[model samples]
Target chain A: MFGLRYLEDVVTLELDASKCTGCGNCIEVCPHAVFEIFEKKARIVDRDACMECGACAMNCAPGALSVDSGVGCASAVITGAVRGTEPTCGCSEDADCC
Target chain B: MNESTRNTGECCQGSSTQKPVEQAREQQECTCQPEEAPHWSDGSIDTPSGRILRVKTTLTPRDHLGTWMVHWGIRRMRYKITPGLYAVGSPTQQSPVFVTANYKMSFDRLRSQLWGRHAWILVLDTKGVNVWCSAGKGTFGSEELMRRIQAVRLEEIVSHRTLILPQLSATGVSAHIVRKGNGWRVVFGPVRSEDLPRYLDAGMKATPQMRCVRFTLANRLVLIPLECVEWFKYLVLASVVFLLLSGFGTGGYSLERIQDVGLRSVLMLLIAYLAGAAFSPALLPWIPGRAFSVKGAWIGLAAVVVLIAYGLPGPGVFDNWLEAGGWLLLVPAISSFLAMNFTGASTYTSLSGVRREMRVAVPSQITATAAGIVVWVVGRFM
Candidate 1:
């Protein structure tokens, strides 16, 4: 989105436990004091602070890290759809682009 | 260059934007430069001198021809790439660092304003896609930024550790983690890059009102011509299909004058395209209701009025009206579908909010479009 929201849920880093394999990859990767190990699994100490990028998922061995990822830009989808191209959004071409 | 090496942030390279409404009322006159370059192509200087400092850029014949052409083809009917970076003039390290994609349109909007600013620009490798879409795909997120930071040696360019980002990009970059991992603090910028000057002058802080995204009529309207361009080919194809189908529906009489039907079909399509892709974005905010569909409907209605004024014809036109109405319904639904998609482009709205809107909006569109088709087919005969 590259657009900023003033309400300070500014950034957060979390792992979905149901999918997590208790891999410590995120803890190893993060530079901020955002994540900590708990019960052999990594947890987001500050969920409201997530920035919404997909780094953990990239390095996570088990593919357990999943966040509602994607740059939420409206123009991108409209641009994709207007071309008769399938939208690059979570929904189908006929669906909302975001 | 290479696909894997695309994360270098070579194309765009920037960060978050500042909100507009908040800046207008702030009353703080910034000592920065006073005239930002025009937002986009009016054939003016690429960069302006306003408090907004546009990122410097140079386009050679070499960048990405195929990719640019493809993107151009895609946007022929709608959508655009505002390439370049910008700053509200005289920017310093204290100016927030914003990031965006190299879609050209996005890049230009970000940097073309800062003539002599010193803010860090971090362009992610969306492979030519813009920010929000790229973020959704994960190309504009943390891994890419970190890699770009490493690749570009961003630390060497700026003294500040804070990297402001477009709010829509949050899905890709986890803030807390970036600070821990890259030693760079992530700040969500603004929804529109034009607001950068006002934002920088206001102590680098965004008010709650600034963060809200409104897809006003002006917002929706500007997108129309671009949308029409994006779908030009589709419109041609649709015209051929409609002409052939209407002839078939008539069984014989209208068969000989295939040219007439073809022209009419194409005209209908033009109207639809203008209404849906063109008019839709222009009339966004003023169209009515919070939902994009309603906004598009308003535009579609306006397109219908345009059709009436142009003399579409008599009962012979009822057949045209059916085509027209079908398009009216169909286009806005398409526009609404497209406009609703803008959520990813702005600072407001979250992933969950988007998902929620889609859940409700999609089913409604599906049903409406299906009905429109049915009525259209029925009208062709009766």
Candidate 2:
């Protein structure tokens, strides 16, 4: 999965290693290989790879992971700003706005 | 293959004559016929549930064509596989059941990687979107998952009580609720479908590498075609408007006047498009700014320098230093606005970050462009 590796470091993904249960959920849920387990705890191996999708944090039962995740598109954010609503990519579960 | 099975497979094929959307609609209607239960083709064996089409794990020519069309933003809404249970190879009651979106590209990516393996694919209707995007929209949420499971009578078809879902879909699905409601365990798989084979082989355990998402240069490049195509109409309109406006400055509508100012303005616009939409994305990683608008402005500035060096727009196009400065400001501002559109496709941006960027960038872009136009008009007429 080669991507714009340099730009991804801007993602605000943070891992509270102290709260990790070492169940490896974050390691499994992250698509960017952002975390690695070391010494029975999860570590941020490649911080630059995080897409800020927040899959790891959602799957983490121990609440060891957190990130400010939402639609990342500029147009969506602008639309939200103009419309005065939470920014959405329009791919809501009930309607196919694509 | 049985007649019903063959017809079902034909429904999945790209129609040569009909519009893609019409064809998809017809296919969707076709699948609804109670007698024509969906089935697989290519040496697939018949099962009690339906025909399990034995399919190769690699992409076919049709699949390649579909991917190419999608890249160009052609009939993208029509590019979906019918939502239902599909079998890859010779799946049985004990085979693993994987859930995904009905977006044809996503389905192709998953099935293509599973060559020589047997599995049951349960595709949920996400209105032709891929899993990750649909998940964010909630189409690939727990409710849909549970609905598909029941609709397919999944409990009866597969003996196993576990369902494998993409890790990216976790945001929309509550694993606890699904387990509590259905007595089935939800196992989140790796981020990429390419890792499915390895994940399955390793007893459903994803390695650290498999979980990470990678947006390589190739991924960024593929998004460019669609961006250019979608924005092309606007680009053409902008060029025409600028050309007309350029003719209004100084001289009346004359062949010489049109050629000198009109053509030059249009040329500048084309350069803006190329710099903002195409070059900015291709040179994404190497660009100097974390913000996409800044990167686009840099590219636009570079283009302006080259244009001035070559004197391509003609010396009369800008009569004074103020007019020249106005062109410089306008070019990069247009470029910046266009480049900002890529934030949706980018891998690193977050909602908060994008909001913050837009709060500042959009206003600045609007002001720069407005001021540049005012300066140019003043320099030309006054």
Candidate 3:
């Protein structure tokens, strides 16, 4: 991230600490280093830095993590709003995304 | 470099003990046709699994050119390799299997980084998307990985059962499921293929730097081409609309007025576009705002200053103060909206953050643009 920060408190990423077995899978998969193991439990240390990529949730075996993840591009949002669909980069069927 | 490596090349050349008919049969067994060999692969290698294509560790001139073209958004979506298994150098049954997307750029980067090393390259069909993106869309998920593994008969080919996938691919792939499906342990490698050599040398362990993704100045700048290209069609339409609008004036629909004011408006818009798409991104970190729209509007404000200075009375660029005021609002609005669009290319933006920004930014942009156009029209009539 090298001094590049997005909007704070806007990411939907959340962790249910009671369910965390602290297998360190979230630390392994997160690109932003958003989670860290604290006393055998996963802690959201840098919550603001989370991009909500959902890698943690997917890899979390105990179902401790969850987030509303999707492509964060503006054009995708605009296109989805116009077309009445979920925000997509339009890379798959439409073939017009970056 | 060694005798075994030389033997691999010779065997692939069909100069060894294997018969021509047998070679043909092996080639036919692969998912890809012999004649349709991807530009990157040199020839096919006969393996216990099947006939897998052999790729060189170095990238060719054509590969470099193709990557450059894709950066400019030319044939980007179709720039893909035939998805299946491939061999780099003379990989043996014990060599590690590296998983990647079918996108040529992704394959090329992973292979080229292997320079002088041997590994099995298992390409997943992500419809030409890079690993991170396809993973986000679920093309690189557990189901696809399990399917590709079975299709290639990977268990029979490799002595080990570990699959080395790019760390970013974890977004879609659940390691536990892949383990549960067939006991093929999934090992997530470094975020970048550039770090492969170190990761491999360190016994498949990744340092913190290898896991974290960074968006330095170079990363931000390289995405500018696609961003600019995406706006091309819109630019043309906006220019035509402004041209038609410029024909209206106190003199009553003069073509001469259109040539003067229309050309100026187009130039202003062009500057605004570059300011938002290129300049703002280059200076993104230094820009004093968390929201992309605010950062873009600041740059747009700077553009307004430059345009006004250039449109001094002797230059005769603007007819009156009202026209200049309209431009001041219009230029920043366009720049702000365009800059907000860059969230897709950025590495660390969240969906919630983008949605929150759009809720406020989009409405403000529309209002500013509409007000600017109305005021400009009123000024023209006066």
- List the candidate numbers ranked by TM-score, top first: 3, 2, 1
Stretches of candidate 1 off by over 4 Å are A1-87, A90-98, B1-100, B154-160, B166-168, B201-203, B207-218, B248-262, B288-290, B294-316, B319-382
Deviation (Å) of B72 in candidate 2: 0.8
**Tens-digit lDDT track of model 3 for B251-356:** 6799998888889888878978988889888889988788889889989988877767886753236777777778888888988998998888888888899999
User: Mind listing the fnat for each candidate?
Assistant: 0.15, 0.39, 0.55
Kindly report which residue stretches of model 3 are placed more than 4 angstroms away from their true locations once superposed: A94-98, B1-36, B309-317
- Cα error of candidate 2 at position B181, Å: 3.3
Every model's Cα RMSD, please? Answer: 13.3, 7.7, 8.4
Candidate 2 CAPRI level: acceptable
TM-score to native of every candidate shown: 0.54, 0.83, 0.90
TM-score of 3: 0.90
Report residue B311 deviation for candidate 1 (angstroms). Answer: 9.8
lDDT of 3 at B47: 82
Q: Give the candidate order by descending DockQ.
A: 3, 2, 1
Native-to-model Cα distance after best TM-score fit, residue B153 in candidate 1, in Å: 3.7
User: What TM-score should be assigned to candidate 1?
Assistant: 0.54
Of candidates 2 and 1, the better by DockQ: 2
* B-chain TM-scores per prediction: 0.59, 0.85, 0.89
Off by over 4 Å in 2: A1-20, A36-50, A62-66, A91-98, B1-40, B43-56, B202-205, B251-255, B311-320
